[model samples]
Target: MSGSESSAPAGQAAPEALSFTVHSMPQPSLADRRSRVLGGRLRLLLVLLACAAPVIASYFTYYVIRPDGRTNYGTLIQPSRGWPADLALQAIDGAAVAPAALRGQWLLVTVGDAACDASCEKHLYMQRQLREMLGRERDRVDRVWLITDGGTPAQALREAVEATGPVWMLRVDRAVLARWLAPADGQALGDHLYIVDPMGEWMMRMPADPTPQQVKRDLDRLLRASSSWDRAGRE
Candidate 1:
């Protein structure tokens, strides 16, 4: 005991020593933790949406609400159909091509028997010319020949068609293909050329006998609209 404190406390009580009781910080409640998690999830979703905005906007502009009105020549398949997962596709060499491989490139698909009659030949010629017509944008488009019958194409016709860029020559079931793509009334399955986006969904179909220039115009619009998101090669 100090002398001052003892002397001062003769009649008065001594002062208590200064002291503190430590308390722990309050913990977060279950509800508060849940809210924090939800907030983090929402922020992640917003980031994803921001990344995909350009692609969504382009498709919306081209398909959903076209400001330029309906000047498109190709028949738009409303609610576009996806590439049939079960649809068996094979290369000319008899190697099976997985349906997933078709993704990541815009496809100009033409269907016909391997025999390739007059109308089929005409379509093939037009297909090549149209891609070429794209000029600098030609590499962005691929020419695909989906042979409906099991038979292989003639060497001469194959040589003629594949003279420039390589053509995706594949064999598929006629009946299976018919179920996926339909022609106009009174027209056969081989009448039209189908337009498939890079994601492998059939979006448009050309006329039974389409004008080259008009077809090119529709392609131009589609390519330009998707330019921001799409690239020239497969993934």
Candidate 2:
């Protein structure tokens, strides 16, 4: 009931400043801040590395421990070139063929006379057999027979090529064909099996008469090597 006693005077009501000592917050030096940031970044990097290790390890195991003794029947050409920009082609039906159409599949190409010489028959057989041996992956590889010299193949020769399996008997000009498929120093265009990759690049040239077994080995290794990225289909 005593307002004067309950309510202190304005001068007395003003609370005095507390006598507590002000302690400054400890400031981190630039080096300390950098160290913490570095530690956090290292931890994040370690997490990412852990996620990537299995895939990287799988590649390492396959490449390093799998005993890479596989060999190719084709002469392994170093630095093989892509299909020349100026290269021209003609299909068996005399229709103009574009080199760009060869992309998206492995091409096992052979050049030979339309007259079907003994050597040409052998190459054709090997090409068929090598492709057949690929099993499920056979469709991924195609056989392209470039009958050079512009000579029209006999009906029997065309029948024989068709009978072998899926073989393309394209009639290509010898001059243009030769420009695309350059033989070795002592070889001729019709003397070897030329390999063109999925990217339309002529990558390898096999011996004139490669054995079926030799060609098979080369294909197996190539398929295995490219399995991570390549698939069955045209470009």
Candidate 3:
């Protein structure tokens, strides 16, 4: 082969190889690549932050703010606690129900048997009356009767309950009931009315004989406090 012929083949090969390499190994610009990485990191950070927000907010609200300044009517249960994991609860009509079902609405719960006494009746009356006093916001709260016994409720009791649309006659296991909402030294479960938040957490318990005015005040304060996060109903 001649010198010029060899040189031409070399030149042709060099350009062809260079073009092939350019097409084979495509690369993004520095700015575009950086932006993609940063965007992915930003999305991951946002997801982590979203998951942590509720715990952070609750700690901030409960610990940072001193309850000393606030005058609350209901005695805040010392060692504010929650229901047991295995809390056995049933429905009035013999169907099973869980504590989670109590979520999504404020619960005004009273523990008693179907054969209610004077105290039981009094608490029941208070529950209904207190809810009614909430006016337009009454529907946001539910009056729940945690009946420990399996005895069926009487027709008269049902009639009284029907008059109040927000009432629920629940049948919870007695042992589970005792585990939670523990009564005073001599008091029975039927004595006092307890307050449970919409989150299935038993937040507060009233005195054995909670006056209507006191309960109304407590309810008002709770409504005011939760107004920021909670709406009128579960939307």
Candidate 4:
């Protein structure tokens, strides 16, 4: 043994050569970069469609092809409309009502002056009957009477409206309302009962003096088709 080896500690051996592993850093080419981008986009698209599926399905069933294949009695509003952000709405007591408050339930809306004319009275009765006819599904719906002026409805009239179920009477500007709902050509806005979906979009407008039986058929189909959809109950 060499002199240095002999002088080393008893258990010590000569120094061994150090070894290292060399790895090539990943350098993605153009195709690899494109693939990654495409993958990310596809994932995003899938997520969006998943979130929108229920809404799309419900709307399609009502607007496009009904399962029973029967045409709707009410006129479908194409590219449905929502309450205008600037629309000034107030409760019966004149408290400000946020537009967001109107969302999250089916709204059967009626528009008229607070004087309770015959046409207005008939519509109020029809609204109640339509809701009652829904049976258990009645709980999923609500009635909104938009009074276009500052006048309060007669006590008897309000009582009649609430005799069966509560009606939301809000004072709204008639001009502002024109931006959210409209009537058939040559007809007044109060002449039609408007159907607003849970998302607050105006979806349907009843014919002038709509028949309860025909309207009931539409409501039945709507409630049936949307059985899967739900929201927080009656806020």
Best by lDDT: 1
Judge candidate 3 at residue 149 and give its lDDT: 86
RMSD values for the candidates in order, in angstroms, are 3.9, 8.0, 6.5, 3.5
- Model 4 whole-model lDDT (C-alpha atoms): 0.88
Return the number of clashes found in candidate 1: 0
TM-scores vs. true structure, each candidate: 0.85, 0.68, 0.74, 0.85
TM-score, cand. 4:
0.85
**lDDT of candidate 4 over 99-123, digit per residue (tens):** 7887778889999999979999999
Mark the 10 consecutive residues where model 3 has the least summed lDDT: 14-23
* Deviating ranges (above 4 Å) for candidate 2: 1-66, 69-72
lDDT of 2 by residue, 1-235 (tens): 6576657677776556679888999999999999999999999999999876754554454445555554345666556578667777787777888887878888989888788788888888788888878999988888998877778888786777777465767777677666668887787788888888787778688776677788787778767766665678785
lDDT, candidate 1, 18-124, per-residue tens = 99999999999999999999999999999999999988899898987886686789999988889665799999889998877878888998989899999999999
Residue 52, model 4, lDDT: 81
Residue-by-residue lDDT tens digits, candidate 3, 1-235: 5577446465365444434444566789999999999999999999999976764565345435635565656656666567888887777777888777777778898888889887888888888899989997787798899888889888898788668685778887788777777766687777788888777667777888988998888787776566555565665
lDDT-better candidate, 3 vs 4? 4
